[model samples]
Target: MVTAIIMLSVEKKHINQVAEKLASIKGLSEVYSVSGPYDIAAIARVQNNDEISELVTQHLAQIDYILKTETMLAFKAYSKDDLEGMFSVGA
Candidate 1:
């Protein structure tokens, strides 16, 4: 799986609407309203890099309320599930 971290800048008064729309998109794993230079942050998992391009260019960018976005591709993932399995006490 290819993982991507997307930072979004939404238009004024449209953060919730933009977040809700992003949450419904396929391959979007998580979306959070955040504070800082960006208004929202999201995680996406897709089958390949091409899918990432399509998701960003075709889907995410088409959303009317989203003003800008910055995408970061993940090289490795370390999840709580993986950590627990690696350090399991038994079996």
Candidate 2:
């Protein structure tokens, strides 16, 4: 599986509404409203890198209040107990 962290910049007044809409998207794993260079952040999981790219371009980038997005593809994970048993490590 592939995972992405999408950082979103949205219009101030639409923050909550946009977050709610993003949460409803099928592949979205989580959403948060934050204060920073961006207004919201969302986590999504898909079977491939191409799938996540397509989803962001075909859907997320088109959401009404979203101004911009920066996506980070998650390559490795460690130290988080909640995710400790979630994936197998290989060398």
Candidate 3:
């Protein structure tokens, strides 16, 4: 699987609209409304790199309220679930 973190700068009034739209997209796993330089952060997981490109270029880029975006590809993932399983001393 391929994963990407997308930071979005959305039109102030349309933040919720944009976030809701993002949540309904096929590859997007999570969407968060955040404060900072960017208005939202989205997590995308797909089968391959080409899917990521299509998701960003075809789907995400077409949203009218999203003014700008920055995408970061994930090289590795470490989650609490994985850590807990690895370090468990007993059942």
Q: What is the C-alpha lDDT profile of model 2 across 3-52, one tens digit per residue?
A: 88999999999999999999999778799998889999999877788889
Task: State TM-scores per candidate.
Answer: 0.86, 0.85, 0.87
Candidates 2 and 3, the one with greater TM-score = 3
Candidate whose TM-score is highest: 3
Assess candidate 1 and give its TM-score to the true structure: 0.86
Model 1 Cα displacement at 78 (Å)? 2.7
TM-score of 2: 0.85
Per-candidate Cα lDDT values, in order, are 0.88, 0.86, 0.89
Q: For model 1, what is the alpha-carbon lDDT of residue 83?
A: 35
Report clash pairs, candidate 2.
none
What lDDT tens digits, residue by residue, belong to model 1 across residues 4-79? 9999999969999999999999878799999999999999877799999999999997899888999999997777
Model 3 TM-score?
Answer: 0.87
Model 2 residue runs over 4 Å out of place are 82-91
Candidate 1 ranges beyond 4 A from true positions: 83-91
What is every candidate's alpha-carbon RMSD to the true fold? 5.2, 4.2, 5.6
Worst 10 residues of 1 by lDDT: 82-91
Provide backbone clash counts, one per model.
0, 0, 0
Q: Candidate 2: deviation at residue 63, Å? A: 0.8
